[model samples]
Each structure stands twice: as C-alpha cells, then as structure tokens.
Target chain A: MTGAPRRTIAIVGGGASGVILAAHLMKVSGGNVRASVIERDPRIGRGIAYSTELPEHRLNVAASRMSAFTEDPSHLLSWFRNKYPEARDEPGRFLQRREYGQYLADVFAAAAASASGSGGLVHIKAECASIVQVPGGLELRLSNGTSLASQIAILATGHDPGPHPDRGFASAGASVPPIDCDRRVVILGSGLSMIDAWLTLQARGHRGEIVAVSRRGLLPLPHGEHRNPIKLDRADIPFGTELSYFVRWFSDLIDEREAAGGDWRDVIDGIRPFNQQIWRDWPISAKRRFLSHAKAWWDVHRHRIAPDVHARAHEAIADGKLRLIAGKVSDIADRGNRTADLVVRLRRSGDRIALQDVSVLDCTGIIRDPATGSNPLISSLITAGMARTDPLRIGLDVTPDCAIVNFRGEPSDRLFAIGPLTRGTFFEIDAVPEIREQCQRLAVGLVG
Target chain B: MLTKKGKYGLKALVHLSRLPAGQLAFVGDIARANNIPKKFLDAILAELRNAGFVQSRKGKEGGYRLARSPSEIKVGHIVRVLDGPLAPIPCASRTRYEPCDDCDEATCQVRHMMLEVRHAIAEVLDNRSLAEMRDTTNDDLDLPQLQQA
Candidate 1:
C-alpha cells in the first residue's frame, strides 16, 4: 500500500455539500487521495443556502442533529457552544445559518491542514462550465478558460434556484437597499424564505405593513422540544400503495399517535430515516401524486421554523404589521417607479385583490419544476448525452449508489451527484444530517 | 395551472353532482367511484366542505352530500375555488385581473388575446352549472389537455 498513486476527485461546487465531502474524503483516504473543490465564490461553504449575511436566517433543524459527521452528532453543538458560550444553555438552539456555514468551512480547512496528505486537497475558485469523460478519468472545463483532470467528478452543484427575475424583487438572505425600511413589502410566498426576508426587515427596523400570500396560505409550524422521537418500524409504514392510501394511513397514524400522548413532531422525525426508502418504494404514479397533492403539507410539517422566529412572526401578525393572504398572484404590473401593483386571486372567496405601492419579494422558494435545472454545465451534459434528469425531473438521475445515469440509461461510476441535486434519488437528503451521511458513504466508496 | 388537487377536487365535485338529490355518499365510495385516491379525496372534500360546496356528517351513517343543488353551483366558481382563474394569465381574467410588468395594461396584445380566451372559457363555465358539466359528453371536449394537467 506504500507509495500508491494518489486518486484525484473533483467536486464541482464548494457549498456545504462539497466542503463536507472534501473533509470526509481526506479523513477516509488517509494519505492516498487528492480532492479539488471548484466554486466561483471565494467564500467556501456559503453556497446559495448559507451565504446569507443576515443574522436572522437560521438553521431549520435543531442543533443536536446538525453535525458535519453522522457518527459524531454532537460535533456541531459542541463547536457552537464553545464559540458562543451563551449558546451553552440552549441545547436545541437553531443558530444563524451563516454561523453553521462558517463552522463547516473551518472544519474543512482544519481537516485539510491536519491531514497526513495535507497538500492533496485544493480549493479552485472558478466555475465548472462542463465535464467530459476521458479514457481513464474525467476532464472539467472551467469558466476561467482552463481544464483539469480527475478520476471522479461529483456534481455538488447545490440547490438549483431555477429561473429568477433579474431584479425588481427582494429575496431572503440577499441584501437590499439600506434605507427602504418604511416601504410596504408584499412577499409572494409565505414559506421559509418569506420569514427570512421579514426577519431581515425587522432587524433593519422596518415598520411598514408586510403582506405574504400563497395558494394554501400555510406557514411552517414551529420546532418544538423533543426527547427521543418515536421510532417507526418498516412494517408500520404502508409501502407500495398509492399516495392517497399512504397519506390517509399517515393521517390516521398522526391521530392515533396524538391520542396516545405523542407529539406530531415525533411522528415526522421518526419517519425521517425511512423517507428515502418510502420515496423509492412508491411507484412513479404515487410519486407524482404526492408531488402534486401533498408536497406543500409535507414541507410545512417536515421543515419547521425556529420557535423564537415563530413567536416573533405571530407577534407581528397580532400587531397588524404582517398579513398573510391565502391566494394566488395573478400579475405584477411594474409602475416603473419602484412600486408595483400585485394582483392576487383569493382562494377562499374567489375575489381579486390588488396590493399596490408595495416592494415585492418572490419568496416562492425553489422552482417547482426540476426541468428548469438546465444550467450551462447541466445543459451541456444533456446536450452531450452525458447525464439526464430523473423520471420525475426533480433532480439529476442517479443509481442507488449515487452514480449519475447517462442518456442511454447507463450509470457512470466516475460521475456522481450529491446534496440537493440528488434529491430525486434520495428525497430527504437536502438537510444536513442526511447530506453528511451521503458524503460519508460516498467517501468510503470512492476510497475503495 | 390545474394542479392534482384541483383536478381531483373537480372530479369529486362532479361525482357529488351525479348523486340522487339529498343523498349522501361516503368518502370511500366517492374515491372508488371516481378512482380518486381516498387520502387525496379526504383533503379535497374537507376543502370543499369549507367552501360550502359539500357538507359532511360525522356518524357512520353520515357521509358527504352537495350543500346546494347542482344547477345553482357554477363550474367556473368551483374551478376558481380549486384552481384559481380561467384566464391563462392573471392580467387577463375578469375575476382576477393584474397587469404584466413589461407590457402596458391598456395595450398589450397578448393580454388582450388572453382576455378573449378567458371570456370564451368563462362564457361556457360560468354559464354552465355543475349539472351542465356533469351532463355534457366527453366527446367534444378537449380532454387531453386536462389529462396532461
């Protein structure tokens, strides 16, 4: 085993996923692997999800489950508490997402500096425009007008935001004009992004009316205290049924669990481990049914907000400052004067309401259609017959082992996917706990 | 955008429209008859109940029935409640109007064309009651678009 050739692994995206994967590869391969993280952002681990400088944006999950390594669940909590001693008292604190992003980058850097083959890891700050399969490895063309070779290239491209407007909208985590504080804000979607933007306004001392609208008008439930979530057995989950049957069964389970003195959060967290399995077991029809009929409800219940943020949001509502509308936005006519008229169709009363003179924020979150993930590199790959979208078009098509599937229906061992890009294959993989586990598993396989 | 929820809700409403006057049908029966998912129908029916299109009773003998006669309920209203509007774009709808940002509200040809389309659809749907929707044959209807939806 001495002096064996070092294997090169290229991760195209230096968000939390790529940073975590790089750290895991270094730890697993000892001194025999070289990994490169390609990203346009000079700041590592601050991908689209985490680059938010806003102090209000926080981790959706609790501190206990947010470790970089699945084996060491308490690493993040310990690190956070050590950094901010005030956090020692709050065991379930949902820290600012920026803090978590910084922690991951710190850990990744530390791992690289202390590794036996410390020089093997490199962070290349450039965009990976395209990749091609070479004879014995892979070749990645960068936007900086250069190319590099690697034995394995994993698309850690992070969360694809889909098609977005050039401007005229405020988004969560993004900095807006410093003094637009007193303007009425009309948020398009009432999901987590809406909360982030609202909180940012609050932090900036905004006192204008904020109206948030969505089709269902559902706000994410707040995270609650929990000990051990109730464990679910494989037999208990109704697999291989139509989504309707599964939904009904799950609804009944919720009732029963509540009646028996169990928190609904327990039921959700209990089924956490099996989400991917359940997603896989369902037929394509069932999958489509769930996406169309039940995804919103599942998202609200599964992805909850921090308790403090929840209380503040409600307080704003009670103060008559924040208004939530359950309806649809029909049109936004820009008056060409910074203010726009947002026409909304009310779902409850079939009424058309126009919200005028309001600054707009499209907080609808990720684009509903995964087919819109046709970025330059992904588009090039599809055009070159290298990779394709999954059947449901949620994300990249991948095998059970996370290998990318090409247009000819062949899984390429050297090309892989992780994080949100692999969501079609592993439905619950967007969160930190699941992504860490994916990185660990893939690192082991890559090292082997 | 006719979502699955809207499609299922429409089918369920149609199923209720065909029932004997004052007759109540269990959710399972509605699901089976219409081939709708029982779980999905459960939510759709609950929404319909809130909208006062259907009233559900609690007991084992109790079930769901239309809150009003099929003739009194407009298909357009049902679609508006479940989906949103008949207009392909929001700026074009009579019931839900908004202007596109890039085009002038008074002069956009696309919005005008879409307004005509909305009028054409509303003429059929708003005028046609749930009874009419149920009575109409599927032959002349452009149903493939609905299936794709």
Candidate 2:
C-alpha cells in the first residue's frame, strides 16, 4: 500500500522536553508516526529536576509566563485554575514543584492516549537501558531485554546532577550524606541547588550552623515586588559580541530596566526569550570567556529564589541558623570523621585579609557529565561515534536546530537532542521556555 | 514556548478543520504550517485522537481528521485533555482541587480569593474553542512591546 513504510521514533528520557517532544511529534505526524518514549524511571515526566515531593519547592518562573506553548501562553494558568480553584488571581504566584510534576505527567498521559487513538501508538517503557544505531534507524535495548528499531531517536534526557569536585571530600569517610542531616553543614557553593539543599536540610530539622560558602558567598536575591507594568524595550540596546562589551551593555540595560520602574530581575525575565538569540549572536570565544570570568556573577543575579524562600533563607541567616560567607577555599585537606579541614581566605575587613579554618560541606550541587547523558540512548550514541561533546565542553555537540553532531562533526540525519542536554549548543536551553521551543522545532524536523 | 500538546493540538486540529470531510492532512503539512516539530506534534495529535477530538486514517492518502466540528471542541477541553489543570497553584485549580497542605480549605482566606481567580481563568480558557483561536487576529494577541525608559 506504500512505497516506503513510515519510520518509528524513539525518544529517550521522558522528562519535560521528552514528553513534550513526543506529544508534538504525535500531533505533527497526524497519528501516522509510530513512537515510543523510554525512561529509566517509572515516572515519565517527573524527572529528577521536578520529582520533589515537597510543596515548598516552587518553579523559578511565574505561571503566567510558563505556558506549555508560546502561542497559548495561558494554557498552564488555565490548568492551575481547574485544579486548585483558589489561587487564580495571583499571577505572580509560585507553585509547589511536586504539583508541577503532576501537571507534566498529565501532559504526557494525554499525549500517549492521543497517539493510541490515532493508530500511531506511543509506548512508554520504564526500562530502556541502552541505545545503539542500526542500519536504518536505532536499536534500543531495554533493561528487560526487549528491543525496538526506529528511524529517529531524540535525546530529551534532562540535566544531570552537578559534578563532584576532586579533593579530600571525595573520600567518603565519616561523611554524612550532606542532605537531610543535622550538622553545622557548610555548603561550598551558593547557588539554587545549594538553596534546595538548604531547604531540604532545614525541612529535615537540621538546626546546626548551615553556612553557604562560596568565592563571593553571594546568596541569590529574592524575587522583588513587581514594580513595572511596562514591558522592556530591546530594540535600542545594541548587544555587543565581546564579553566585556556584553557585560557593560547588560549593565546599562539593567539601569534602563530600573529606570522603567522595574528591577534588574524584571529585565532578566524580560530578556528570557531572547537569551538564545543573544547567546548565538556572540562568538564562541566570547561565550567561553563568559563561563570563565562572568558566570558566577551572572548566575547569582539571574537565578533568584521565590520571595517566600528568600525570606526564609534571610531569617535563617539573621537568626544564625544559616550563615552566608564569602571566601576562597585555599585547600580542602583530608580530616578524620568524613569531614575536610578547609583553609579559607576570607574577604578582608577594611582591606586586611584573614585566614579562617572551617569545616566544609560540598553543597556544590549535582554534577552531570554534560559531555554525555546518563540515558542509555545518549551513552550508546556517543560510544558508537554518532555524537560527541561540544568543543566548549558545556554539553553535547549539536546543531542549532538540535541535531546531534557526531565525532566526525556531522549532524546525524536521524538523531536529535533537546532540553538541558543541548545547553552546550544553545546557551538558554536549560529553562522550559527555551526547551519548549526546541521541542517544537525538533518535532517539525522529524516530520519535515 | 508552548509544549507540543499545547501548540500541536491546535495546529493539527486547525488543519483538519479546514479540510473537507474524510480528507486527512498528514502531520508534516500541519507541522510546517504551525512551526511545531514533527516528532512532538505526532504525540500531540495522538492525544487529540484519544480525547475523541480527532480520528486518523492509516496507509496511503491517510492522515488525521477532526472527530467533531471545530465549534464543538473547546480549547480548554483540549488543554485539559492534554495538559490536565490550567492553574499552576493548587488553590486555583478546578479538576484536581485540594487545599494547600498547610492550610484548611474552608477557612483559608487565600484559598477563597484564588477560587474566584480560578473561575475567571476557566471562563476564558474552557469556553474558547479551537475554532475561535484560529480565527483570532494576530494583532489581538500581539505581545506588548518592551517600553524604553
């Protein structure tokens, strides 16, 4: 009945992007494309990022802006109403991360159901262990020994945990699992993950001195009150390509946003959609230069806590429950009892520096080897020479359109990637807004 | 960025609604028009089918058609069918309603306020059909320009 049969697609990792990709593919194929989503965990959409059971952990972005689709920006807001029917007026409300997880699950389920009804069938296997390229498409090996051959594979595996730095801390002797413990836990990094760690610690009744120490020891700023009703204008600001120029330009832009009756936070949120374009616009040298010199400052300013979390963190600091310290870890020598003796160069009081000895916790956060994904499909593709890490070592090598670039620097015709894993190629890829766009584009590529 | 279900549900449905009865448009054609990725759109259309919104025809000259008229398919229904609840906060949601864990629902002042907001949001999302969204002018929903200081 047909000259060539339609090829099935296998999407590895059923996180937000993976599920979104599957759902989009089903729609684009008009139920003609056979597809399957392979996730290591039983829960498809609730990956490590959003799998938290805590209600206090909230989405970083506002619900109004976090629609599943850009065109239908109100979709998420709509869903929120049908479920809660209580918090609808609060546009700036932050929701429990666990509930968001449920929302994601619902989306995935709907997509799978739709696929089945269309005769296209979307199978979600909870145990795909490895993926290797076959002659026509891909050979996916599941943990249960079953395999599926498909024409296209999309790596939508989400972010891996942060890396564990080498040092005496690596030796797990007497080291209390940094999380859910009652100790004077001194976290080494002050980022969102550290905040998460802090929240978890506090929630678990860790009453000891919780010091979040870093080079600058800067705690993320709290979400400021929404001051400006005016949208930010981008046309007047000419984005410079050099790191120095970009920094200056961004600083000026912050001033501009403030002048428009908003804070730098508003400016950052306003530019969220254009971040990819801005990253792409810059030369690789500039992007790399940013990572080395400016990333820390940029991150502190960019990723902020919800106001409620920020207040809690601040109160903890004021009450001596948590201490934020700025210093350099000169050395982390091995000490007995799973603790490391840290030599720190504390910022000078009045231009005179002092050295302090403190026991430290490596709350540096989850380290995922970005060069490779934890998913079996990504691991297999890399081993098979179908994909390689980016030159910058930020993430996997992929084209702007999200195609996987092999060791030979060739974009795979049948394989693609998206979500946090593609951050190397697209700097703004970590957030949902960017990934949703990528999912849409990647789905179009599959059919086109 | 709309999730594949959010965008493609409207996309494939739009294409199918425009076509004559029994004539199905392939996923590729609809995706190109809507700028949705093919793979993601595929899953989204499948969702529409399962929700009893669309029907598919396999083999040659086969694709998908709407199960009901565009007028009958509300945008919120598709969203609920695909994305679950529209509200992000529990107190605002209608279908999966449970009071925030820390507070009592009956006496919670915040919960009562949110309920009103939820009703307003539902009025718009649940009532507006895909046919109406398709007909809406771009200018009607044009993104506000970033104002310069």
List the DockQ of the predictions in order: 0.01, 0.01
Clashing pairs in 1: none
lDDT tens digits by residue: candidate 2, B15-63: 7878876678888889898888899888888866655577788888788
- Alpha-carbon RMSD to native, per candidate: 18.9, 19.8
Docking class of 1: incorrect
Which CAPRI tier for candidate 2?
incorrect
lDDT of 2 at A49: 66
Which lDDT tens digits does candidate 1 get at residues A1-448? 6677888999999999999999899888877888889989998888977888887888998878888998988888778877878644477778888998888888878777866444378889999999988899999999999999999999898766543453345344344445377788887788887888788788888988889898999888898866456765443354444566568667876787799887788788888988987787565777888888798899899989988889999999999999999998888888754468888999999899988878777677664334445368877887788888898877888987899999999999899999988878888888888999999999999885
**Any idea how many clashes model 2 has?**
79
True contacts kept of each: 0.00, 0.00
lDDT of 2 by residue, A1-448 (tens): 2334666888888878887787778767776678888877777777766777766678887777666676677877788888788764588777777777778777777777887755364546666666677787778787777888888888777765432446434311112254435555667788887787677776677766777767778888887777243242222222223466557656876786678566777667766666776676455666788887787887877777798898888888899888887876666666555455566667654232322333455655433455443445566667878888887776788899888899899898888888877877787777677777888887777774
Error of 1 at A63 (Å): 1.3
Question: Each candidate: what lDDT?
Answer: 0.79, 0.69
